[model samples]
Target: MAIVDKSTLLVLGPAAWILLAALLVLAAAVWRLALEGSPAQMLVAGLRALVQLAAVALVIAFLANRGAWAFAFVGLMFVVAVWTSGHRVAPSGRWWMAAVPLAAGVVPVAALMFAAGVLPFNALAIIAVVGQQIGGAMSTVTLGGRRVRDELAVRRGEVEAAVALGFQWPAARLMVGRPVAGEAVLPSIDQTRTAGLVTLPGAFVGMILGGATPLDAGLIQLLVLISLLLVNSTAAAATLWLACRGAWVREPA
Candidate 1:
């Protein structure tokens, strides 16, 4: 089947409520931006995202009964994730190299979880871990990529000055790169530091809802926190290396 299918909702039941909520959000975003500007694209994108999610939910509902389907779905998700990260990072052929960070960061953690039996190799467990991996990678990629690009734009002269002073590309970029990449980690760090105090993470609430004890929920949340750190760390490191190599080099203004 084509990636996107033509589908419609007649706006009834819970879907009607959801559509109302979505329209509200669209109106809010447009109003925030000043309705002098068109939000047609934004509305379309929002609708697309909602439909895509609905389709995925339907697919997962079926996958719950088939382990292979779940695995395949996870694989497809990773592929789409890499495509998205690459597009945002470097809209060029070289972006394909993002496969390294995308896979390297997520796969090992997943492998370790399965090997150590920390995560069962079942449909639900795989889905959960894979979801976490994709989310972590997405965060890292967006942070690392956007920061590097923005820093380069703001500090191109600094980069050139360093290069003129005999610094190699990597060393020259380090002045802006290190700090930006470091900042990229702030969200994850803040989330970790304030996990329970500021926000109850999904894992904890999910475990509780699933009838697990609070102790079990706490342990699972802790494990998830650690796992996300590893995944993001690896992705950021890989992204930094790619940036240093000028894989995402800035174009002249």
Candidate 2:
């Protein structure tokens, strides 16, 4: 039976659940032993994944074939992305400013895809496409923004030294933090570079299982990867720009 068949999920149902639990236990064990991390955190994350996916699946059931309502759902997803990424960057309630860089990454690519007729306006396609892009943007924003915050915090003296030497704080902060912020895109870069060699990404594997030809799967995966690269790099840069402009500064004046 095809892995992507609708009934396959039901067939594999209990087995899949058990497999996921086993994997979670292994991860939790590794976390506890290798990193001295809390096993509870790992297990909790697994549980959250189960619950959240179930909830999302339920929502998608209703959202199916609901043309413009999909956009509304995307808006909801964007808000969650912004909030989560913002909190990740700074937990001190400056989270709202995350919208700027997040938008910088997600919107242009989405608009381009829709306008170019590359992506259908259907609920499934729109949600899948924009959801992944938004996820990419969120991760990059969190990484870049947090790097800027933490780097500026620890390297406050460098910022001060630059400021003392006739440079402005913003410029000095940028000089110190931009490099770290720039590193945020390295993950996406490496993922793109190593795709098919190091790992079959979910999109590629899923499409293949869904009966798409290998070439078609590869092309779609390439498109997804390329789009993520654009969104992530742009988000990282925009995060840096926002940080330099003082969206978040862990260093005191």
* lDDT of the candidates, in the order given: 0.79, 0.88
Candidate 1: list runs displaced more than 4 Å.
1-38, 249-253
- For model 1, residues 1-253, the per-residue Cα lDDT tens digits are 1233223213246666666777867785875587665566666666788799899788777777677667887888888788888888888646676778878789899889888989876677788777888778877887787788778769989999999989997888877787778666678888999999999898788788778999989998998888888888888888887887787645456
Q: TM-scores, in order shown?
A: 0.83, 0.89
Query: Lowest-scoring 10 consecutive residues by lDDT in candidate 2?
Result: 1-10
Candidate 1 global TM-score: 0.83
Q: Pick the candidate with the highest TM-score.
A: 2
176 Cα displacement, candidate 1 (Å): 2.2
RMSD in Å for model 1 = 6.5
